[model samples]
Target: MMTKFKRLALAAAFGTAVATSALAHSSKETTSPADGSTVAQPPEAIVMTFDAPMRITLIQVTGKDGTNYPVTRTDNMAPSKTFQAVPAALPDGSYTVNWRGLAEDGHAMDGSFTFSVGN
Candidate 1:
C-alpha cells in the first residue's frame, strides 16, 4: 500500500522524466550565415549545428520562387552534431533551408529557416 504523499512524489518524478525525454531531440544550435540574415557574397555551402549527434535524413535549400538548387551532396555520412552541403551558385534572392534529421534518441525532427543573398 502506497501512502498518498508517496504516490504524489512518484507521479512528480515520472512527469519530470517524461518532460526531459521529450526535449532530448536534436535541436539546431547555429547556422553558417545565421537565419534571416543577408550576405554580400553567395554562400558556397550551408552548415548547421545541432545540440546532439544526429543523422540528417533530408536537407534542401530552395529559393523563394520554388527553385531547388543543385546540392552536390549532404555531408551526413556519419552521425554527428553538424551537417553541411555544397549548394550550387545562388542568385540574389530569399532562400529557405528545410531539413529533417534523426536524433540519437531515435526521434525524428524537422525544421526550416530563411536567409537572403544580396550583391
Candidate 2:
C-alpha cells in the first residue's frame, strides 16, 4: 500500500541510479593516428585518450596479415587520461590497436582502433 508520493519518490530514485551507472563508464575520447585514418608514414607512437582516468592493462598492435607488433608502453600501467606506447618501425599496412583497461569506477573496458600507413 504505497502512497502516490512514495511511488514517485521510488521512481525518481531508480532513475537517478540508472543515470549514475551510465555515466560511470569511462570511454575512449580519441587516438593518435586517429581511428580509421590513413597516415603517410609509420606513426612514432600509439596513443589513446579517455574521458576519465583509466589503468591500461594490455595493448597490442596487429597487422592485416596476422602479424603482431610489440609496443613499449610509456604509462607503466598507471592510471591516466592519456596513454601512449612506442611502436617499432612499421611497414606500410593496415593495423589494429586493441587495448584493455580498468576504469576509475572499477570496471573493465576494452576497445580497438584501426589505421593504415601509406603514401
Q: Pick the candidate with the highest lDDT.
A: 2
Clashing pairs in 2: none
Per-residue lDDT tens digits for candidate 1, residues 8-118, read 999999999999999887889999779999999889888989989888888889999999987776564677888888889999999999988889998988988889999
* Residue range 1-119, candidate 2, lDDT tens digits: 99999999999999999999988899999999899999999999999999999999999999999999999886878999999999989999999999999999999999999999996
State every prediction's TM-score relative to the real structure: 0.92, 0.92
Candidate 2 residue 15 Cα shift, in angstroms, is: 2.4
Error of model 1, residue 16, in angstroms:
1.2
lDDT of 1 at 111: 88
Models, CA RMSD each? 1.4, 1.3
Each candidate's number of clashing pairs is 0, 0
